[model samples]
Target: MGSRVEEVPNKQVILKDYSSGFQKESDLLVKSGSIKLKVPEESSNAVVLVKNLYLSCDPAMGVLMRGVPVPGFIYPYKPGSPIYGYGVAKVIDSRHPNFKKGDLVWGMTAWEEYTLIPKPESLIKIEHTDIPLSYYTGLLGMAGLTAYAGYFEVSSPKKGERVFVSAASEAVGQLVGQFAKLLGCYVVGSAGSKEKVDLLKNRLGFDEAFDYKEEPDLEVRIDVYFDNVGGKMLDAVLLNMRIRGRITACGMISQYNLQQPEGVHNLMNIILRQIRMGGFTADNYLHLYPKFLEKLLPHIRKGEIIYIEDVARGLENGPRALMGLFSGRNFGKQLVEVACE
Candidate 1:
């Protein structure tokens, strides 16, 4: 038997109830909880107890809070329980052989100071420590994989092709635009705010970026479209796609909070333009994680790729940070710092 460790006070962000329409910060509540420092011996399955350092605030998390059935890969957040999402953590105790005390990992974890992961195999052990550990929450984690697979595999992009990315300043979109530029594509991105537009053009190396609010129409013809925000933006892009254009539908953030999702009138353009459209979830492409790292790590090391993050300082601010994703209030990848390493 392992030595006993005392219970500790744990702060948690709990889901208050099922939500509809726009998600508000009040939908999540900060509560005080408690947990033992060691994995329980009575557990039937392998588990790892972790000290969470960072929690990701993603647009998809809002979908999980709607009090509806979710995909098996990501279960819905239960009301009165701590909400779970992608995070970076340090293992405190483990019944799983793959992890041990002090091991760093990134995967789905609760919005609490401490979390007990029943399925330890889902966690990816952090190998390279050279990059900032917080990066795993977004740029080096799910967002990175989503962009890599969607653009390279699904879209099958080529050099000198024209590419357009919607919601181009968010976690996945920013990386998609950068990846397109790295491949010698002419990239144009649409962002909600002037700040995000400037971020895409000046820092992230996009050929051009425009504020969607200021310019409602997207007139440029493109060979590839990475659709992050669906609805009217997608309708506009459909009209501008060139012959044999490829469309990668990664997410429809614009429609997530709506009671009735907006319709895309130009889907017929897919047939007219001979566009190849593919929708994918990053969980499906996880097998390629090692390959993704091999391609991305070097660019990150050399500063060829730039990633931005807007961090909320405390667990108490987690709700607001998450809600920011829908309202375009977050300047970059929205994340919360639950505890500092």
Candidate 2:
């Protein structure tokens, strides 16, 4: 007779209710539930069990918490259920052909400690382990992919071109500035804090970095603009874009929490200058993952690229860490480390 598997407690971060306007830590609740360690006998071969190790906190998650059907999101998080997002996890058991027990993966996962992924194919197997595993939540995962696709595929930057990026110290923006510099473009970045501005110039190698809050004039002509914070910043960039310049609209962290999203006043510049502005999500360019890895892995290994992360320990702190993204309180990529493994 086969031995019975023991049931274990699964700690989870649950959404208490749909958020309106800005989000507070009270919106999320930490709860505990029980799950059997073994998959059901009748389950399909595709089922995979994973122990969640790290979870990424992103601005887009704020939009999802509004109870609206966000673009590229399958559905809104149900009230009283665990919220899900990109995370790094280790497989505890698997019936899938592509994965087995002990494999590390990064992809979509629930906030719970243990998750039964019915569609295991959605996860990406981690092949490179030399870098920190937490990087899967940022540099080696969605944010990195977004930056690569936006800058390379969307912008099509040329050497010596003038490039500008907003919210430059954030996860994706930091990488965008570094990528532009590596490509031989003259890069300038704007951040909300002086510390972040310093990091952009000193650590990330940006040619110039400015504190947007302190700058009186934001209009500065550039050949390429990577827009991470939308609203006024995007409007200012539009006014400054050179003729035939490119703008990659990767995200709008500034507009996510507003009741009425701020409107851009200088879109007419696009027409006058014959500029190209395109909005994209990482999912659209996922087919280029192999190409991105090929280009980025070497940079990471050689220490040419630097990644900064603000880690919150344990599942209990997940709510506060996520809230920090909205307030620009986090220094860099925000993450919750649920477990050591």
Candidate 3:
């Protein structure tokens, strides 16, 4: 059975252009329309109707807005269409055997207030709602999975090892530091601002944190770097890494905005120090998501883990919230709260 394409209210972020360099909020224009409440007229296929509840603003979103499909990567947002990122949503209606009405899910979604997900395979149904729903957009979603995968799978950390994180106050960065501490490592973090440095130390339980902006020689300031920002910080960290150290490249936030990306100065160190370096995308560890929960959920429930989020008010603020990431304006995990059931 198919329902008529119902008229409904919707808000969305429209791509203004390819985003030449550092993104300005104007690069993403918020547009509203009377979107059809029902799925498209293409055909009768399994799909789910959802009212967007939460949208995440992340560093990688910058690349997605350009609509550039890098080799071996998914396509980006196209111009004149709504932008989609990671989000937590509620199923309003479903034609898929795997989904039904009122099921909460988190995965890839649009920056719109209402969406009809044509491909539900990308979305993961939420079985646990005991934690905050917004967490699905950050700590409990890709961010959490990234920290877990990067640390445990890629970095191959051992207890009492020295660990440091760049962008340490952001979603994944914060959790990586916490995970390191739980492993009994001497954990430190670097953030752009002093306040974030304090939060990383006082609230997140990092052993030490420093404002990277204030430090002239990050290479000398820290012994190890988790390498999130990944431009100059990565170069600096390379010089400072311990013998046979590990570098898990989770993201390259520092270069996202640059007209020309910064070059790493210390590549020779990798060969000399025998450091093990690797990069990971969350999807690679999707199979391990369940195992991750087995390890992570308990820590979260027992108050051994913590996460922080900087929530913007509505879909209209999506552009600003996203641009703020480059400027390091967001205090914690940046996300936009659209609406909930």
Candidate 4:
């Protein structure tokens, strides 16, 4: 006559309010509440139970947490709710037939131990178990797809071309740089710190890497550009790009927090050089997932491809990990490891 399932304490990171600029730890709080082991009949209409494994804290999350609206783009996070971001998780129960218990998946997950994901269609089911599970949070996930679709599909990369990626040591940037190199192109990347620059060059095998904070003349720095960082970096990259070069606007981490974003000043060169640029988001190429994974997985297993990640423990670290992305504190795919399976 009564529910027999034990109530679990949901330790969740709740956003106190929307952030205007840089977020502080005070912006989020970890509190415990109640959740039933089984979804109620009323709740089972759409809900799927997920135990989050690795929660990705991306540069874009900084923009998402600020609650800003950009036309025709993904909307920002709402205030007083559990912050949702990409994660590698296991579906423990499901109302949707597409998912079932023990299925590993990656998609928008809450910053907590467990989540009730409503839309299962957006989630990608994990099939391979040979690779490290963390890969699903970055290299084998949205960041990897962004690099594949944006650079290869949209920009139409060719062998021997020169490629540049901004924030090169970060998750998406690191993969983009490597993808270009694997295609027999010269790859260069820019980072905010010297350590990241070194990682890009020495560790990730990028052809060249620069610390943008130390370089005052980025225009002169990039002789051939494959621009990822936008805003003023786009302006500088434009001036340096080779004739007829293309740029993929993957993200604009440097400008996310600015109230008035810096503008690109070298638009004229694009016309003069016949340079082409395309802006891309992951959803644009969701159809290409299987193809992209087919091409990328072998490289990953062989160690021909590598990723960088900065992981923080506990859901309480969500704000710090998310905020650190803008300042270049996170070395790679910034994710909060809520649980391990």
For candidate 3, write residues 260-329 as lDDT tens digits: 7888889999898887889878888888988988888888988899899999988888889888998999
Worst 10 residues of 3 by lDDT: 65-74
In terms of lDDT, the best-performing candidate is: 1
Q: Candidate 2 lDDT, tens digit per residue, 122-208?
A: 899999998899999999999999999999999989999999999898999999999998999999999888999889988999999
After superposition on all C-alphas, the RMSD of every candidate to the true structure, in Å, is 1.3, 1.3, 2.0, 2.0
What count of clashes does model 1 give? 0
Report the candidate with higher TM-score, 2 versus 4.
2
Off by over 4 Å in 4: 1-3, 70-75, 219-224
Residue pairs whose backbone atoms clash in candidate 3: 6-37
TM-score of each: 0.97, 0.97, 0.95, 0.94
- CA-RMSD of model 2: 1.3
How well does candidate 4 match the true structure in TM-score terms? 0.94
Candidate 1 wrongly placed segments (more than 4 Å): 1-4
lDDT digits (tens) for residues 1-341 of candidate 4: 37587678788888888875766667787878777766566775667888889988776666666776643234676787887778899987788888889999988888878788877778889998898888888898888888888778878788887777887888888888898888888887888888888899899998888888788476443323545567877877777877777777777776776888897778999898887877778877889999998998899889999888888987777778877877777887888888778
**Per-model lDDT:** 0.91, 0.90, 0.84, 0.79
Model 2 spans > 4 angstroms off: none
